[model samples]
Target: MQHLETMPRGLPKAVKKCLEKSRDSALLAVETYNKPAIKFKSGGYIVLMVISWTALFHAIFFRQKKKPFYKKNNRFEKKDGDYCYWELSTCVSKYFVADTNNPIRKNLEFFIPLRNMVEHKSIPEIDSDIFAECQAMLLNYDKIMLKEFGNKYCLRESLSFALQLYPSSKSLNNAIIANPSTKPIVDFIKAYRSGITTDIMNSGEYSFKAFLIQVANHQTKNTLPIQFVAYDKLDDTQKTNVNRVAALVKNKFVQVPVTNKDLLKPSVVVKKVQTALGNPKINKNGKEKDKFNMDTHTRCWKKYQVRPENGNENPELTKPEYCVYDQPNDTYLYTEDWSDYLIEEMAKEDEYNSLYE
Candidate 1:
């Protein structure tokens, strides 16, 4: 700083003055923002940095400027006041404020009378009836919207309700087609409710049940809830898994294959378990004359795969050859019991002795 001061002036006086002006302008930009008076004023006037206070006060507050807030509607009377009331009344009438058909535009002419009565010094006080109308108008709008849309969208499990209403109708929306084509339903319903797509299904973003209810009434005009088709068909264990999956997601209405139509086929379970198990000939290859032995196949099948209950087919484990027991001890035990391990070891010993002889 001392060196800068001591250095000979590098330019003529005019140039130095220009540099000083530039520096002063830059410093003033920051310094004024931190000034105490500008920060503390509580008047209605907002502080702005574009102009100096002396200029801003003269231009903004002293001038008493008011820009137009609404466009003049030609149908209304020839005054801004007439249009202002019309707009407010229109908003209220269309909302939960009144019956769906209340005459909002007609009421625009009356707000002037209402405002003038109590507010202006010479005007008479507003009647209690006039005051009550405005108050009631404000209260009913929220009640109306909530009741109208909120009640319509509850999701139903059975296609019976939706099938009655959708698909065949030409105007059906994509949301109503809650089939595999319209996405997994759970994800779409969630996005509709929370207005956010999320990985965490139940992260307090939106309630799944609430979302389905909305979709049933508003968004998914044609589709039924995913769960209703065959909930009764799920065994207790499968039902429990469905409940667990529902609890983890943002929306509980998953297209979980709970119905017999949706339940994973035995072949699907076999394929999945086969990858986890050594390729034991548990299920017979299609058209292979001999099916896999029952004791070995059932033992292997039960370890990794669950048997489908009731009307489901599991030909791999159910074939007659698949039921054979080499040594019958109990009626159920063939080659599958704990004793099979002991018995097999003894058989190996006998074979080894025969070869040695």
Candidate 2:
């Protein structure tokens, strides 16, 4: 599924530390729950079941309707992106709760029952490993929840702007090793946590760019699979050649009139060897051929021009010039790759780096 494509990678240090702490807490919950712990009687297990099931359902169906600013009817509508990020944040919170009334507690309440059915479902097959790990994952979610919410601090996007100091000072491995209980959940959370803060520096633009390209590639593959006119199946070299030729025939989108005139110049010219043994002579009238369409002059010309004082209609102007009033009012056309956007991004990166450097 597109939604499950990639988790964030190259995490900020704070997220890494949060992951470690949450992970350790998860392993502790699992170890404690799995062992007939010193406490947590039959009633406690029932409480765990309800909480886990509720959490599981919430994660599975986290979608909800929210009002957006730009609707004509001014109605609230469902948006997947918001739900996904918030739910994931909730999933992280499920690992860190110290008391009741935590939403993450409710999430756990929802998850645990399904986990029991999944693990102990005898008439059919059961997967103890997934069930066990998911339970641990949910526990880690509690740790994040408890740290942020238990003390009256909600760790959702609402507080994302407020957390200036993150846990970057602490080493994730050290935190895990010190805690000892959360190695597995810590590792798992850290793995999923990569995409967590591409939003930290808020540079999801790069991620979003790659995402759009992948989406375009998928759409193209589905609607316009490659077709070769000359060759049924081209080797890599042939494909490269076709691509180059396609690039060569593209029309330029120059805004300046002089530059457009310069581009209109013949890219190539051929001369016949009229005199093999004698000196060459420039032809009085050389016929241009092949490089571009002959009608290019008509298409590129500005519709209106000035008249000469002496009754010469097309005097003085050596090249066809364009005027703002001559062009079609609403005509729009599409061509070219998004390399301009990419180039601008690279320029911004360079500028930012230069500023720091």
Candidate 3:
């Protein structure tokens, strides 16, 4: 509960400013998120948290870089003229020694796509659906903040439990049914969660697990207001039996809808692009060749960085959200959305110059 009433004089000014901003933004985010009056705008809370966390990382990177923190062509910069100091995603990759499965990274991945989707659109169910992840995000922030700065700078005490609104199976079910417009959000959440491993999904650091308890009113003021009894607080049998409570929340959401017919193979993707682009041809190595061939499609995929790299063996890659990998057939699966993206990107070059003219 140490208060940073004033910026310590000895520390670098940039580091101080960045850390201060980060702390402020984090507090604002949690405050905004928990306030029911502005529940509709709670998605903005994630954006703020991202900004705050990004700044905190930048401060760390800057401190680690020390004297040359502002020097040109450092790891934080792309070129002499191009700087990536303020970019969150780039900073995470450069500073944090984390993998794709890291809890912080995983949580960020969930939020990043979500933030993109709900940027302008008022997705009503986002706050309710992402409750666990949002709780974990704040918890992670405080832990990392303490680890990075020190216990003195941690904000754990400032954050309290976000009391459950409806903490029973029937209530939760009714809430889901009443909010039918959230179907798309529910589908996206399921598709994304389905792609992640069970360990990651079940990890409290990745997504906080809340077990609803009906507490009796305390007449004595000396009784604890709210207590966080960790797993260790429970005996071995209780620990093993906790699965019963977890089952209450597990697989309760709508499963991702299966659309088995729309998937297309690489050859089909190429053919579709070629037909859409007027079946044009280009001069290859001493010979004229179809411009929209498999090679061309491969080049396009790499250029645009279509995620879940083609032919990746990761089981999650075949989830049919972005693309699916057929195990037995040994082929990559793509959808109509991917086809449209390819055609749209290829059309910009417009190999058939006559059409633009």
Q: Write model 1 residue lDDT over 1-357, tens digit each, in one string.
A: 112233246433433332333223323433432343442211111111112221211222212332112344634344645432223323334332444323222222223222222232221111111222232222222223134323221111111222211111111122234333323222222222222123322321111121122233536656535433243478999979767665654344333221111222223333433433333342345544212233334444344232322234442243222232111111121112322332333235453234324
How well does model 2 score by local distance difference test? Answer: 0.30
Model 2 regions more than 4 Å off: 1-74, 77-124, 151-357
Instruction: Tell me the whole-model lDDT of each prediction, alpha carbons only.
Output: 0.28, 0.30, 0.67
Identify the runs in model 1 with alpha carbons over 4 angstroms from their true place.
1-86, 89-112, 122-135, 144-357
lDDT of 1 at 218: 39
RMSD of each: 32.1, 28.1, 12.0
Q: Which candidate gets the maximum lDDT versus the true structure?
A: 3
Write down the lDDT that model 3 would get. 0.67
| Model 2 C-alpha lDDT per residue in residues 173-237, reported as the tens digit of each score | 54355555444433332322221223321222111111001123544445643321433267989
- Order of quality (TM-score): 3, 2, 1
Better of 1 and 2 by lDDT: 2
Give the Å shift of residue 191 in candidate 3. Answer: 2.8
- Candidate topping TM-score: 3
Supply candidate 3's per-residue lDDT for 77: 46
